[model samples]
Target chain A: MIPVTIEQMSMRFGAVKVLHDVNLTVQAGECFGLIGESGSGKSTVLRCASLLQDGWRGRAMIGDTSVRDMSVAQRCRSLQMVFQDPYGSLHPRHSVRTVLSEPLKIHAIGDAPDRMRAALRDVGLPAEFLDRYPHQMSGGQRQRVAIARALILDPKVVFLDEPTSALDVSVQAEILNLLMRLRSEKGFTYIMVSHDLAVVDHMCERFAVMQHGRIVEVLDRDAITGAGAKTSYARELIGASLAYENAL
Target chain B: MDPILTVRDLSVHYPGAPVCAVKSVSFTLGRERLGIVGESGSGKSTVGRALMRLLPDAKLSAQTLTFEGVDLLAASERQMLRLRGARMSMILQDPKYSLNPIRRCGEQVAEGVRTHTRCSKKQARDKALAMLKAVQIRNPERVYDLYPHEISGGMGQRIMIAMMLLTDPDMVIADEPTSALDVTVRLQVLSILDDLVRRRGIGLIMISHDLNLVRNFCDRVLIMYDGRVVESIAAGQLDQAQHPYTRGLLAAQPRIGGGRGPLPVLKRDPAWSQPMEIPV
Candidate 1:
C-alpha cells in the first residue's frame, strides 16, 4: 500500500472547479514532487492532503487510515504543512519558540519546552533563535523556522507548498538542503509543490506535471532525462526552465 | 558616442545615515537596456530612483547627475517638472501601490500623454487604446475603463507599462515590473518591454533581483551588492564573469541539469562590496 494515497480528489469554489479528478501518491521516505505553473492546482493538492483544505471529494488515505475518518488531532500529528511565502506564512508577532510550541499545546503534547528545543535543533537552527521573532530573522532563517514548526509535531507526512520560491538563489539552496537532510534523519514522506523545473529535476524522484487542474503527465527521472519531452506543454515548460537555467 | 545618461561618483543617502544607500555608483546608459541586479536592500532600486530624481523625501546628494545633455542634480523644481515623466519616466515595482486605486487606468494614462503632446481628450483616449494594444492586451477597449483594483497583477503591470510609455520618454526605468508575475507572464511583460524599447529606441534601465533575467534581457549587466556595482560585463558573457562575487552567485543557484551535491555556499566577504578591488 502507498504511504499516502490521494484518490480522485476534486475541489470546487462556488461552481468553479479548481481541481478535478486529481490523483497522487507519496511513498514513505520518498520525495514526491508536484510541478506546475501558477493556478495549476498543485497547492490545492498539498492543502487537501494536509487537511488545511476541506470540502473535497474522494479519499486522502494516510497509510490505512482514511483522512476522511481521522480526527483533527490525528491529522495534525500525522500530517503537517509548510507554506510558501515565509514572511506571510509565519505570524510576525510570534517568536520562534511560540510558533513551534503553540502547535504542541494545541495537540496537548506535554514537555513543550524540550520538544521546541529539539525541533529547533532538528532543522539546524541554533538555540539563540528561540527568543527571536520572525521579522528579525532573514528569509532563509524564517523558512527554517517554518520547517521546524512543521516537523515539531513529528508528522508522518510533510507537505511543503512552494517552500522557497520567494527566496534568493543562495538562500534557497540552504533551505532545500536542510529539507533533504531533515527528511533523511526523520524518515517522513515529503510532498513538495513547486513551479521551478530545475528544483523539481534536482530534488524529486517522482513528479506529476500539472496543468489547468489536472495531472497532465507523470514521469520518472529516466523517462525524459535529457534533450526534450514527449508532451508539447511539458517540453515548453522544460524549455523555458532550461532557458532560465542556462542563462543563469 | 555620448552617453544618454551619466553618473559620476553618484551616491544617495538616507537622513542621518553615515553610509549612502547607493555608493559611488558610476555607469552610463546608451540607447539600450542596462540591467542592475542585486538582492533586497542591495540598493538597486535607489540607483533607478536616483536617476529620475524621485528618491522620495530621502536625503540625496550626488557629485554629478546628468540626464541627456542637462545637469539634473542642480536643476530647479520647474526645470525638473518639465523633465520628469515626459522626458524620462519610471515604471514602479508594484502597480497596486503605485497606481491610483480609485482612478480609471485609461484616464491616468491619457493624462500622461497629455503632459507631453497637445492632443485633445478624445485623441489621447485613442492613443491609450493603441498603446494597450501594443502591449498585447487583447480587449483594450474594455480594460481601459477599469480601476487598478479591478485588474489582475499582470494586467495592472501592462497598464503601468502603457502609462510610462505613453509620454514617449527618452529613457524608461522599470523597477521589478514583473517580479510579482508568474514565469509565463514575466516573459510576456518582458517581450513587450523589449519591443517597445527597440521600436522607440529609448534608453532602458531595468532593476531586478534575478540575475539570470537581467543577463538575458539587458545589453550591459551591472551586479550590485551593498549599494555598489561589483562588476559590469556584457550581458551575453555573464556566465564567463570574472568577479568572485558574480561567480559565487552563479554557483549558488541550481540549474536544470546541474547534478546533485552539497550546494555551494556564498561566503560573504567583507570586501565583496568594498570599493577596494584587487590591485591591477
Candidate 2:
C-alpha cells in the first residue's frame, strides 16, 4: 500500500490560486521531493498535507486513511514536520527538555525522561543539551534538536521544508547525513521541499517540479544527471543548477 | 593598469572584545571579480564592511588602505561622503531592509543618483528608469511605481542592483547579494553583475559563503578561516587547494549523484588559526 497520497489537491489564498489540481503518491519508505522557485506553493503543499493550513480542497490519505479524518492526537502520532529555519522554528525561550517533553506530556506518553534522552542521543547530541536553550546552541545543534523533537513521537511520516538552507555547507552535510541515517534505521517516509536540485539529486529517489502552482514534470533521480527531462522549464532549471554559465 | 583597491595588514577589533574580529588580512583588487568566502563568524562580512567604512564603533587599523590612489584610512569624513556613492558604492544583501520601505522603487533609485550628482528630478527619473532596464527588469514603468513590499524577491534584488549601479561606481562591494535568491533567479542577477564588470571594467568584491558559487562566478577566490585568508587561489583550481580547511569544505558538499554514504564532516585543528611562518 502507498504510504502517502494526494488526489486533486488545490489551495487558494484569497483571489490568488496558489495550488492547482495536484496529484502525488509516495511508496513506503521513499523520499519524495518537491522542487520549485520561490512562491511556487511547495511549502504550501507541505503545510496542507501536514494539517498546518486549512481550507484546502482534496483528499489526502496516509495508508488508506484520510488525513482529515484523523484526530489531532492521531495526526501527531502519524506525522510530523521539520521547518526551514531552525532559529525561527524552535521556541527561543523554551529549553530543549521542555520542547521535547511537551509533546510527550500532551500525548500521555510515559517514560518521558528516558525518551527525551534517547531522542537526543539518536540525533547525535549529548544528553546535556537538554538543559540548553536554542540561543545557547549553534545553528547546526539547534537543527539537530529540532529533528529530535520531530522524531520524538516516532511518526511514520515526516515533512522536511528546506531543512538545511539556513545552515553552512559543512553543517548541512551533517544534518543531511543524520536525516538519511535516521530514515534508513526507522523506515520513515519523507516528503521534502527544496529548491536545490543537487540536494534533491543527492537524497530523493524521485521528484516533481512545480511552477505557477502546477507540477510541470516528474522524473527519477537519473533524470537530474541525464537528459530525461521532457519539458523545457525542467531542462532550464536543471541546466541553470548544474552550471552558472548555462543560465545566462 | 593600476589596481583599483589595495589593502595591507588590515585588522578590525570591536570594543571590549579580547581578540580582533578580523585579523591582519591583506589583498589587492584590479578590474576583475574577487570572491571572499567563509562560514559564519569567519569575518567575511566584517572585511567587506571595513572596506566600505560602514563599521562606526569598531576599531579599524591597516598598514596601508588605498582606493584609486586615495588613502581611505587617512581620508576625512567629508571627503568620504563625496567619494562613497559617487566613486565607490556597495550593493547590500537584501532590498527589503536596504531600500526605504515607504518609498516607490524608482524614487529610491533616483534618490541614489541625486544624492551624489547634481541633476533635476526629471533627469534623475530618466536615469533611474534606464538603470532599471539595464538590470533586465521588464515593465520598468509598472515596477517603478510599485513600493518595496510589492515586488518579489528576484525583482527586489534586481532593483537593489539597479540602485547601486545607477551612478557607474568604479568599485562595488556586494555582500551575499544573491544568498536570499533561488537558483534560477540567482544566475540572472549574477549575469547582470557579470555584464557590468566586463563592459564597464568595474572592480568587484563579492562576499559570500557559498563555495560552489564563488568557485563558479569569481576570477580569484580568497578562503577565509578565523578572520584570516587561509588560502588564495584561482577560482577554477579549488580542488587542488592545499589547505585542510578548504579540502574539508570541498569534501563536505553533497554533490548530485555523489556517493550515498556519510558525508565527510569538517574537523578543525587549532594550529590552523595560528599565523603562518613567513620564509625569510
lDDT of 1 at B145: 94
DockQ of each candidate relative to the true complex? 0.54, 0.57
lDDT of 1 by residue, A1-248 (tens): 12888999999988899889998777878888888777889999888767778898888889999987889888888888888999998898999988988888888889998888898888888888999998899998999999999888888888889898989887888888888887777787888899877777777888888888998888774443565467877767766666655544
Instruction: List the RMSD of every prediction in angstroms.
Output: 2.5, 2.0
TM-score of 2: 0.96
| Model 1, C-alpha of B65: deviation from truth (Å) | 0.9
Q: Least lDDT summed over 10 consecutive residues: which range in candidate 1 chain B?
A: B271-280
Clashing pairs in 1: none
The CA lDDT at B246 in model 1 is 84
Error of 1 at A164 (Å): 0.9
- On TM-score, the leading prediction is 2
Model 2 ranges off by over 4 Å: A245-248, B277-280
